[model samples]
Target: MKHKTPLLDQLESGPWPSFVSDIKREAEARAKNEKGVDFQIPVEVCEDILGVMELTYEQKRTHWKHGGIVGVFGYGGGVIGRYCDQPDLFPGVAHFHTMRVNQPGGKYYNTDFLRKLCDLWDKRGSGLTNMHGSTGDIILLGTYTHQLEEVFYELTHDFNQDLGGSGSNLRTPADCLGMSRCEYACFDTMALCYDLTNEYQDFLHRPAFPYKFKFKFDGCPNCCVASIARSDMSFIGTWRDDIKIDQEAVKAYVAGEIPPNAGAFKGRDWGAFDINAEVIDLCPTKCMAWDGKKLSIYTPECVRCMHCINVMPKA
Candidate 1:
């Protein structure tokens, strides 16, 4: 028996606000004057309704089921279990997405690996994704009734990458590009960040913690990543000792070869204005001395403030 399209039937059935009304109209028009309707009849429906129905049915079908598994990947990797909802679907299988570990500083996968992941995503589950979720993990949406382990095996076929960050765990850390390029850097922040990530991978993936943790590093005092503001753990490099002062360099600065205020030394109001008398007197090392005609640095007492160099630039 042929069934008239449900579209128009549904629309004319009620004035209730819905997309079902529109589709019912279309379906009725398409299957005009049809007799009996089969349960298999494919009536057009909105994507949202279809998705909702699919999810609802899936949940119902799998409810009370146990042992389903899911995985998340990004800054770190790990599997999660949903032992509570529909234990039937995951019988002996854990529920929840596994996390994929990430290299420190947000490294991207190589072309081949990326291609493989895309292919796997297309075949195994819902195409929906969270590129970098709050925990900094790549989130894959919707896994099947089974096949979690297979998916895990396929994804980790290459060298075992880490699944680093997740719930209650230390989050993926970030840092500035350190001594490699910047002149201001006192340490290799990038390397340090990576090392820390490796050293603390367990702390990253586990859910055992009093509170979520975050870490960040800066090569210098600039604090490029705002480590102090956002991170539970933060590091910034600075010299415990005074800045280095070259007496000859200071003289050269005095002779105009170097600008007195070109770098950090260029700031004003050093508590002294006169190069020979006031500024020199303030030097902790008594580095700066005046002969009433020419200016000289004791060299041994030079505290590296570059104050005398700034004032007596012509000495």
Candidate 2:
């Protein structure tokens, strides 16, 4: 009995046109040689054999990996490429590179910048992008060893502005859509994110921590960015006081004969929490009252939370 040649053995032969076709041919030949031509091997045989062959090929390709940093020029060039040269040691990694591009607040990029980035990726990268890695930098993938520095230089245009990601320093800072778009925004999240990035360029490039750190900002309580779940440091805006009630507004509401639940105080469930009447009853001004038709809140004893205010905004 002779040992069967593996399906991939042919791909290792001089330059093969298509590994898949080569495997198919090998499979046919194996069937013929085994006197099992009439017997149908499971379709899964092809899949399993091809998978194993591809894995083997990939293992050979990754035997030596090459890696280095490349940066896009201006506005802080992004970090690109982590390729390895030694196949015996690092292999298939040469086929893939990782590049980081800085994303502005709200992940907005000007048309010129976007075009330049796309052109660069098409010319040199794997033509794939992660569009914001874990650190919030746009991640470009795939490149070769020889193309690393050239791609880096081309992307950075000679290190003019600054790059956004890499090393031990702080990654890109992400911010929510601030005052420009959100009505509840109280601060300029965009300006703050940019300021932090510019002020800490050194920190962004140098690895100087036991672990990586991330900073994120939310314009309001809605927290659209999921900052609280992932960021080490996060800032979210929230109102500290309760809703304000105007007595005149309440009178107008009453005169208008609007439902007690109408207006800014509508659809509120004040009873969601157990109210302590002992605390309300001890009110220095007997301001808390439930009159079946409406709750009365003496402005003097009203500490906010809009409990009574929601029940009777005209209070």
The numbered model that scores best in lDDT is 2
Each prediction's whole-model lDDT (CA): 0.52, 0.55
Off by over 4 Å in 1: 1-100, 104-109, 141-147, 179-184, 221-224, 238-315
Error of 1 at 254 (Å): 19
Q: After superposition, which runs of candidate 2 have C-alpha atoms over 4 Å from their true positions?
A: 1-81, 84-95, 158-161, 243-315
Model 1 residue-pair collision total: 49
Let me know the TM-score candidate 1 reaches against the reference structure. Answer: 0.45
Clashes of 2: 41
For each candidate, give its TM-score against the true structure.
0.45, 0.53
Report the lDDT tens digits of candidate 1 across residue range 210-229.
77788888776667776778
Error at 148, model 1, angstroms: 3.9
